[model samples]
Target: MAKHYRGREETPKTAETPRLAVRYYPKAGKLQLLKRWKDREGNYQVGPGVTLDAEDLQLAAEALELIEEFVGSLGRGGRP
Candidate 1:
């Protein structure tokens, strides 16, 4: 059997950016959310942001979408 990283780690949305990272933990049988940010020194940091255990991939995906939209609205000086 081939070892698959997707079952064990977060999937980066892009090679150039870390906008929305997601991972499925086989052990936990749940979907995880990853978030990224930069510090005052301009160094990047990444960490686990959230975990959804309702067993609904669609719900988790929808939540992420709403979050992205809210952030975008905030950037435009609008209500999130």
Candidate 2:
């Protein structure tokens, strides 16, 4: 079996309200996108889970642009 580890444990009402985080998983040797938000129960949830390998730079850039655009559109509107 492959050893696995996780990162980015976000929870409700955090001071930073984390914006999309990217992590490098050593065992997997890939970059993963962690977009998390709090549910009603204050549990962190990852939605639209994403992962990228070395060859996926273009896709990664595009996805980041889209996310930024979406967030910009929601300025001061409400939470994510």
Candidate 3:
């Protein structure tokens, strides 16, 4: 019988947040966002990543708001 090592004997596992990959496609004239982990799995994933312009502020603003709101919510749930 194969002995399975329990949690205490098992090797430690390290967790990391997947990174976001951004690149500018010269031929398509656009910026793309790729999942670092997903890109490693297969080759058929075609993408026209998220498009952006030099003057585009909407995406930046929205990202900021989402982060702020998340942090603000955490603060509200804790006691002084």
Candidate 4:
């Protein structure tokens, strides 16, 4: 079985919602953004996630920045 290490998690205010986490897989030397939530039995489960490589980091950051700008503009009533 492959071993993975969990890093920081961004948890939701409600328990019913899935939390996002940053995980590392040493064997693959990769970072992933994954969701973790509880099942009906109260056991934690891992859901499908995005694997980000070195090349994708900058692109993802820029995309998120644009999203942030758009969201911010909404409050200011400005065009994004």
Candidate 5:
């Protein structure tokens, strides 16, 4: 089994809310984006997520910038 460490919760968890968190896998020495959601029984269940490599950090940051620009272009009413 691979050893891993979960970081602080980035988002609040609610019955209808999914969670996003950062996780580190020591064996792989990589960081990953983890998503969790509640099941019918109210148990937190892990969902599929993406593993970010060191080289992809800049690309990820650029994507966020693009998203911010796109959202800004939407204006106050969000109709664009």
Candidate 6:
């Protein structure tokens, strides 16, 4: 079985643009994209917002692209 790795890796050295951390819940059949942002205290805050369906491949692809763009905008050591 493939191991699932949650977002627990070390944060990059440089500031990272906001990236969507996607989670696929098989039992729920919904894709959850986490909206991450830094608080005023410079602490990381991740919240769940958009919920999509697995059957919608196009939507999923679009979401992925959007997330990539969001992360890439951060500049170096950002989301991949």
Q: What is the C-alpha lDDT profile of model 5 across 1-80, one tens digit per residue?
A: 23343533343232323587556644444566668878999988875877644444455888667756877989978764
Residue 63 lDDT, candidate 3, scale 0-100:
64
Question: TM-score of every model?
Answer: 0.37, 0.39, 0.25, 0.42, 0.42, 0.40
Q: Return model 2's CA RMSD, one decimal.
A: 8.3
**Which of the predicted structures, 2 or 6, would earn the higher lDDT when compared with the native?**
6
Q: Please identify model 3 stretches exceeding 4 Å from their true place.
A: 1-21, 25-30, 34-44, 58-80
Tell me which residue pairs clash in candidate 4: none
Question: Per-candidate RMSD vs. true structure?
Answer: 8.0, 8.3, 18.7, 8.5, 7.9, 9.3
TM-score of 4: 0.42
Worst 10 residues of 6 by lDDT: 7-16
- Model 4 residue 11 CA deviation (Å) reads 23
lDDT for each of the candidates? Answer: 0.58, 0.56, 0.45, 0.58, 0.59, 0.58
Q: Worst ten-residue run, lDDT, model 1? A: 7-16
- Provide the clash count, candidate 5: 0
**Model 1 root-mean-square deviation:** 8.0
Please say which candidate is ahead in TM-score: 4 or 6: 4
- What does candidate 4's lDDT look like per residue over 1-80, in tens digits? 23343433432222223576666554454567678887899987876787645444455888667756777888775655
lDDT tens readout by residue for model 2, 1-80: 22343434432222223556555654444566768788899877765656655444445778667767777878667655
Better by TM-score, candidate 3 or 1 = 1
Say which prediction, candidate 3 or candidate 4, comes out ahead on TM-score: 4
